[model samples]
Target chain A: MSLRQILLVLKREYITRIRSKAFILATLLIPLGMVVFFGIVVGISLWDSDTEQTIGIADRTEVLYPRLQEIASERYQNLSDLAEDSLQALVQGEEIDGFIVLEETHIEGQKDPEYISSGSGGLKLQNTLRTDLREVIRNERLARADVSEDVQKIYESDITLTTTKLTESGEETEDDTGFLTIVGFIMGAIIFGAISGYGGLITRSVIEEKTNRIIEVIASSVKPIELLFGKLAGIGALALTQMTFWIASLLGFAAAAGPLAGIFLSEQMSNMPETAQTAQAPQGIDPEMFSIPAIETSLIIYFAIFFILGYLIYASIFAAIGSAVDSEADTQQYVLPVMVPIFVAYIIMFQTMNNPDGTLSVIGSLIPFCTPIVMITRIAITDVPFWQISLSILLMIGTFLGTMWLSAKIYSVGILSYGKSTNWKELMKWVRQG
Target chain B: MAVIEVKNISKSFGDTRAVDNVSFEIPKGRIFGLLGPNGAGKTTAIRIINHILIADSGTVTINGYPVSSKTQSMIGYMPEERGLYKKMRVGEQLIYLAQLKGLSYEESKKKIRYWLDRFEAAAWFDKKVGELSKGMSQKIQFIATIAHNPDIYIFDEPFSGLDPINSEMLKEIVIELRDNGNTILFSTHRMEQVEQMCDDICLFNNGKAVLNGKLREIKQRYGKNTINIEFEGDDAFLDELQDVRINNRSANYAEIRVLNGQSMQEILKKAMNHAEIYKFERVEPSLTEIFISTVGEDNINPKELS
Candidate 1:
């Protein structure tokens, strides 16, 4: 292969895309869009915070109303004195957002009385109401039983879990299972996005040169294999540039708004089921239990290795697919089969986060197409054995070489050909000819 | 010395034979025409010579070396279907193509500027190819083909889309290239264009080179054997002519072939008595007549040519 020709082709590919209007717009606008989106969300919540829900509580039990009023007087009012008809009129006329009538059965019996309303306030208002009423009832019952006020106060306090991993070296490190899952998923998602997004870029590039008939002039100048490598490397470099830009910008933003960034991240991690509720500090537990685990230098190295191999393997497949067809719409059959593995690997990533060393995760990490995402994630969340990591890396190297060779072959012949319906059989024919 | 030599080269696409057992030689500093009708394998042969397609059998050598990237670097090739990256600026695109052909970055930039200035396309340097008109882009494609300053230039149907003014201008530059000792090979079905430019001509029909020789020698072999008759009368020509083939018949014009064997006086006198004759002369066979008649005859009897 002529490295010079490849470099020249690569240079052209890189410069044009870096200067493209789409790249510049996306680079500048995506972060701005995110800021605006989050601002709207935060703004709506802050506005909602000011509008308090006034619930007129018609307490049948004279004992509970006084205790409820003594607690949250702002959200609850005594509707107990009003007639039922008048209470209904108050809710409909918007005098009160909603009202709850406490019947004698509710105070003495086991039932939750419905809060009749015009459906103005949602679940959050109801959730807070439940917590307030429960606290009032619990306090009254405990007080009547002659329990100490200190015991009641201690009962409602936080209890958090602290997990420390005992490494083979006998070093105690914070077990960052949940936090590490987020890191792995973020990196994996970047890989997945690069493959699909930059893969389309490569495909569209191939189609552009082919359909425009520029391939003929290029073929005469350089070998098709050179063109193939040049294109992959060029676009791959561009993808890395875009990814790094986004990540650096994200880090800067996080540093500038440290506390808010923490809240946003924890909010994202809410679904991961962290042991401690971050909104409140634990009474006596170590705060490090909620700390984000440091992404180690070795883990970053593994990420780089898997990410590069994964990008090459999938990018070559995309290039081959692009060469085989004359237009983007004609790429359906080839694109679908290639996407299935990535989609499957992504679905299994969530499962891997929860159970990193599960059989499915191990098997997925061994398979060529799914390996990069699953293995990196598994390594992040838990300790993956040396042999498995080694085997995974070796398998990835083999797949990348094979994919590069195969795609080059298909690409060389397919670009010169035009206006034939390309199928699996036709593709194979091209491979043989190539 | 021969700049290019193809010996018994043949290529096939599945069941279809695109080029079959074709061979020719192009000496340095000469203009050669690869002449053929549509679908006659000229493009396939041109591609094979450029190493864009490898022949199924036989050899193609450029300057005594087998066609490879090294030799490809010495050749500037423009394919029949001209195209450039629509989104790329003219200057950068030319530099990119030049670099691909093994020119260094500095050399490419220098040459690109010179060629753009030469073509009067310096203003188009910053313009994307998509913004240029068809004829203007054709100039850009030409500049790209030649800017690298390779040893040999191959242009397929280079004169097809050009207007007469630009066509004449391109012809002047081509002749200049020839005078500077660069081998030029271009293919065209337009015999008229090749007539003024080619030192030698190879005529292709159905993937076979049926005629190959020096341009003058090929025309000379057919001899001065046609009478051009342009008349203004509707009166029918007397049907007393014999042993002479008539062609290019029209209401006011006809090419009567005396064709070296027949006497022209009888046919001239016959036309003279029948209608008002404006012009008549014994003319040597034009390349168009020779090509048509030769191809027509080749189609029927299929003579072996070397």
Candidate 2:
């Protein structure tokens, strides 16, 4: 109950953990790791549309080939010297990626055209022919019907889909569901990793104290509950430190990723062979797409609140598990049960992220153990109701207080009892005794 | 006035009563020995007094206040299962423990430096506890216990891991601490330690204090009926000694108990005809014999107790 004693223990636990090689490595290496992983993903996205090849066409209906050739993806070739059977030979010989045969029946628009491919990563070639062939066939048919050239041009224009979110006050704001889903998934993953990862740290430290027989000396100096709080607070501080490093570096990466990945892509493009360059590079992906969307300040505040409450609830339970066992290996049976809720939260998070207001998502976000992750995802994805947020926070705090008392009881008794393999019945007895 | 008192303290773990109605007091500035064999509830009693475990129905007082956080700061306790923080530096670990016991940062550092110097472990100030040898860590553990300079000291088996030279040094330091008006209480089943150092003693067996009194008064009450002889030729005369029990026999000496009005002079007169009598002295019973006689034969198993 004494603040001074608690602080002393806190100081010891903090200093020792901070100075360890593991903490230093994790703090430094994880950010470095994220940068590498992000760079690789960006590289793959950039390279996906950049494949280059020549497409050959055999037009049996003489008039269609010339007009099709006019819409210049200049990588398309007219196979004028080829016999009908030899067009397949050209594609198979690697002289062309694939060949499309346009017949009088395709021009009549009665049937789908045939495009044969060697199928060696030629799916993009088939998709391009499909779109262009349909456009060419539709224009030919329209011209046969005596439609004007200006009307044909108007029919070929592309259409795009956009969404606008309408507020209760009759204002509208542009919303992208893809962007929101990314935000929700990212926040949910970070929360899950932190709680599951740091809870083990609390358990390990308690086991260290018990195995070394230093628990007796400490138990005499301070109350067991004081020791438990100090331990949780100290290690909780370390977890926060690590989490902050990850958040800052990762968010910084998100902000700067456009330019960084752009530099990586250009360097990669310049390294290609001369023949590949002559074959032509396709239009590039927008570099802006690589950057993460801006996050709201209120969401960060909710995340902070939930992350801390969630950590304390789980960390105290881990501490109790630590006190109950003599070795880390003995913690396996207990850790599995604790991990079940986290995995459940993880599995339910995707459903919650997509439909933030659905019944399943609503229930998932309200459960105390799942609230920290699922509720944060909901906030990231859309505007959550004030009552739901408040109730979730209340439930989280209430669960933490309840778990704190239960864990303190088990920890106090278990730390002092040594050299016995404690079972569930024995642990129940300890809880009652405390 | 007694410095520490435990009144009617009883604790039970499951069906086993670890400490049963144990009542004892440690007088100010005196060495009190808590003597008991293994599993005899000595640790449970020490833990209750230290407030590590609260007794089910009893009161423990330090100075005049009941045992609470206030009194907790007034006592130093080194448990039998004591260990240092193995991964931490010697000085840093000591300072942390001292601060927990209510010393300031500056005061903890100062006391730590003084104790490490006194123990000749100043060079190891920055050395990790895991790097130290067993005896070396025992020295560090001792320093940690006393660095705060509390009014009362309780050390359980403080000499268990030390070499003879270090053990002798520790005995001297304990005596010095007592001389400086700090009450000391230590538990040991080793009777020789109690015989050599204790001003008072309490013997426990099966969760009950079997015998309790000043060590001098207890010895006098047992009466001086044993003779210790140091001689050169003790080949066969020891077996022939009449009306006496022989113990602690060796090539040069033997301890003999006189019983049934047997005379020491008659034994000495008989011994002169056989061997050279270098010295003869009558002494109080050894603590081992007293413990056996006090606890009764059925309860005392010398092999296991020792």
Candidate 3:
């Protein structure tokens, strides 16, 4: 009830948390480690040479020999002239990635023939040889009857498909849409990770206090609500600190890695479909989109609303669990129920990635339990309706208040308890006692 | 005037009535001891006083004001659980807790420094509480509890974890605080502590007070008709002496409990006729013996009368 008292508690919480090795490591090292990890992954994916792997040619049919010669001269220039014995030896040693022995299979009543590869890894080679051999054979037959390469080009161009997604704000963004869909999955994953990390920290803190029985001294000096709120606020600040540092470092790294990503992306896009190529083009980096101030403000607002609500929703329940049980060992049993909803939210978010405007996505975003994660994704990709956003916020606030009321009842009853395991019936009685 | 007064305080946890009609009054500037064995509801009673747990039925008043948020500022409580934020430095933790008890930063710092120095723990100012011994933590907690200089203090087993030397030091400070006009309600299972530190005592058994009065009065009222004699005499002569039961005998002396209506002079006369009387004195029963006799034998539920 006293502002000075609450501030004193808050100061203690901050001082203690900041001095800990765990908080320091989480705040600083995690972001750097993540950047290094992702950087390595990206680097490996980009620089790996798939083109250097050699495939052995085994054209026993001799029907496809000329076509194999042409492919070897063009796509595969590093081919060595070796006998079948050497080729089989190379295949067994895996010195060659694979070997393609084109065997002509005579199928009764079939218009053409079938070619098979010696190993599964040579399937691509087999396909290429078969198509080329078919063309050469067709040309030979067609010269007797006349067909041209122009007709083949026209046939291949007819089957390409393109798609588009209109953002809720009505701007056409990412016509390919698959990469944009990953946005929801990423948002859900981030939310899950952040909440679990901070919530576990809060639970650990409560367990520490409980095991130490320091709650007694604290309860004497401050109200339960004051203690609970101060704890949530203090650790919540730590979580935000870590999150901010991570975001800032990531943005900085992305900025620095921009040219590298652009060059690689451009090269990659050249091999991709036209839709993917346009999506990757460097367009000013949209300086506004990268503005720390704007993103920071939005994040602050987002966390301010969701963090308090989400944290209290989790923390109050966690505190209740801390009090209800006598030890940390007992806490593991209660964790699953708390975790399931968040897990469900994540699964639902994954499904919504492709159709952000789908019925399931719309409903999931509206639900308070999933709204903190899903709505953030919605906001990141598209402008959400003010009314819908307001409704979700109100729902979260309402749920938080409701949870607090319930958790306080549990805390009041559970804090002094010992030597016995708490069960559902007893918890129900505690809740109803209010 | 009563510094703290509780009337008909009863609390039940589910089906168990932990505290039943426990009423007691603590007058100003005196040490009031709340003595009880384990599971006798001493903790529940203290928690109710602190407003940490509301009594199912009772009225509690501190300095004529009902127990409320405003009244809490005038009260200092040290729970038996020995709570301290272990990760925090001793000085920082004390200062923070003192501030919470309504002291300003300057007042808290000054008081904390004084107490830390008094306890000879000034060297451990920057040491984390978890690094401190149990005695040192207790010292810090004692300072924190009283830093705001509350009119009423409830110290539940404050000396439980302390060594004899630290216990003596704490007892001295407690007496000094009492002299300085602080009303303290002390609770412990150690009856010797109660005898030494308490002005008045209340003994609870089964959520009810079996014995309650000034320590002097209780000891006197519970006194046995006995004489302790140490004489330069033969043990056989003392053993044959009439109208005396030798409770204990050592090399040159014997402690005799004279029967009711037997005069101490008569016992001395018998002793003198036998041998030279080196020492002869009538004795009051010790508080420890009185407490044990009172609670240990009485199966009758100390009536939970309001």
Candidate 4:
């Protein structure tokens, strides 16, 4: 097998696929779509947070009116002694977001205070109301008991726990489990999508050549193994190009998201401060989460390695399947067997995310078929043992070589043998003959 | 000197022996024809010669070098199932194929232009192969086959999809290539094409060469034992003929193979008694007849032979 010939085939495969509209659309559209989708989601959440609600309170108890007035800020409207019918009219007219009825029995602590709204209030609003009412009630009780203000202030102080993870060397690191899980999930998805998508490209390319009978002209010139390698390398390059675009776009979005979010928040605040303050603070995903992870270099490098090896192995299998069949429809039987391992790996991905260092994750990471996705997740979540990473890499390369050998053997025979569908027995026969 | 020499090559797939003990020689600067019916292993033999399939046993050498990738580069092969990249422009596909045959990009580009012009397909340079008519693609495929200007060419069923006009055009180009000192070997079930073109012929049946030799010598060996006659009112005399196998019989014409040392005069005497003989002549059997006679009655399909 001449390297020059292989390179020629590779050039053809690469140029044709790269120039295809489908490749261009997919490489650009998928990442753009993901960015647009996330942007809308975040924008909606922020917009919801800026919409402040006006809560009208009907304080039935004359004793509670002063406390309610003191606790109510710009967001609250104290409608003391307002009749129930008028309050209902206000709620119906959309004048007040909701009304709170503080009955006289509230002093006896016999019934819960009622808060009504057309829609459910934001969590932040609910928390703020609960805290203020509790504080006001506590102060009233404290005054009756003749407690000192200093004691009450001490009692009202808030405490928060500072969490840290100790490393193997006893260095305290910020607990980044949530952050790591998110990163691992994103990385795993990228690897999976790249492998299956590019691998499918290899399959369809092979089937196209086979059906068109171009394989005859090609097989006459280059060795079948060379053709297989050329296809794998070509499509692999295309996949890498697409992945680079996606990574760049993702990083670009992450970098710009902070300022973009700030601009959005400031605009909303200026437009409607009352709603903005009362709205629930955006939940969970901070803009800082999009910042480059701590192990970004190593993660990116390992992801590249795993992705290349994974693509080689799977694409080889797909090429072999393509050769053995005449058309895409005939691929169903063979495709399932090849895809089962990948499906298994995908199913184990969630478990790997939860416990990256668990025995299941360790085993999955070592397995050649699952290693690309599972091991990347493991690396993202925790510091995997150096030996484990090395072994996984070694096994991936070794497995790819074996698969290439097997696939080339089958492809050499299957490409020329047309008309009849090939079975496992015939494939095995070809392998043995080779 | 023989440019392609096959020595007892055999290949089998599973329980079926696709090619068995096949041996032939294609001398340089000559057109060789490989002929057989469907499933007759002609394709298998050609593939083995191209190094697309390895022989189970025996050897194949091209210009004294064993059939390897190096030798393959010196050969041009257009398979029975002709194909080109459907989405690629005709010129680009030709250049790509030419390059695959070991031509440099510049060399391929130059040759591609020459061949496209030769086939009168210069206007189709930028047309995708899928957009071309079947006959047009055949021309492009032919050009691709010979664009690298290899020493030897092998085309299987090259004229299968061509119109009669395009077929004659390709035939002329093939002959022109031979005159230019390129050794050509083509496989076809079209007997008339082979008879008109081939200097040497290897007839295959059931994975073996049933007949092999120079075309003239093979025909000469059959001798002038057949008669071609065009006559009118031959309503009953043919039934009176003995030891003769009649073929292509019509109301005004009949081809008769005289066997058992039968005399042409006896057939003539009987024919004149029933009808006026417009023409009668004893002639050597055509390649179609020789093919049928050699492959035997049991194996021959009259429709395929015709």
lDDT by residue for model 1 (B1-306), tens: 889998999998777789999999999999999987777899999999999888999899999999888889889998987799999999889989998888888999999999889888889999999999988998888888998899899999888778777788789988999999999999997767788899999998889888998999998887778888888876366346777666667788887776447777878778888888899887777666777677775463222221
> Cα lDDT of all candidates, in order?
0.84, 0.85, 0.72, 0.85
DockQ of each: 0.77, 0.66, 0.66, 0.77
Question: lDDT tens string, model 3, B1-306?
Answer: 898998999988788888999888999999999987767788888888888888889899989988876677788888877778778888888888777777788898898888778777899899988887877777787787887788888888887777887788778878988999999998887666677778998988778877888888887785766667787856567666676556446877666655556777766777788778778787866554455557653553322211
Best-matching candidate per lDDT: 2
* Residue A324 lDDT, candidate 1, scale 0-100: 90
TM-score against native, each model: 0.84, 0.82, 0.81, 0.83
Q: Give the proportion of true interface contacts each model preserves, from 0 to 1.
A: 0.80, 0.83, 0.76, 0.80
C-alpha lDDT of candidate 2 relative to the true structure: 0.85
Give the per-residue lDDT digits (tens) of candidate 4, residues A1-434. Answer: 68998898888889988899987887778877987999999999999877878888777765565776776666678787688889888989999988888875665667777778877677888887787777766666676678887998888799997768798899898887778888888888888887777777788888888889888998888899888888888888878887887778777777787767766665666566555545744432345544544545878898899888888888899899988888788888998888887877877888988888888889999999999889888888888999999999999999998999999888888888778778887789989987
**Between prediction 1 and prediction 2, which has the larger lDDT?**
2
The residue ranges of model 2 lying beyond 4 angstroms of the native Cα positions read A44-157, A168-170, A249-292, B225-283, B300-303
lDDT by residue for model 4 (B1-306), tens: 889999999998888899999899999999999988877899999899999889999999999999999888899888988899999999888888888888899999999988888777899999999999988988888888888888899989988878898888888888998999999999988787788899999998888899999999988898998999988884578978999888878889998999899888988989888999899998888777787788787886666655
Which model, 1 or 2, shows the larger DockQ? 1
Q: Write the per-residue lDDT of candidate 2 for residues A1-434, one digit (tens) a residue.
A: 99888787888888898989988998998767877999999999799767766777777888778877787457578886678679888877888877777789988867777667687445666666677787788888888989877887788788998888786698987776678788788888888988888888888888988889999988878999999999988888888787787778777777788778876775677678856754665433356666666677887888889889889889988999999999999999899999998889888898887688998889989999999889999988887899999999999999999999999999989999887657788899889888
Candidate 2 residue lDDT tens string, B1-306? 989988999999988999999999999999999998888899999888888888999899999889887787788888988787899999999999988888899999999999999888899999999999988988898888888989899989877767997799889988999999999999988887778899999998889988898999999987888888999875598888777877677898888878788988999998898899998889998877777777865886667565
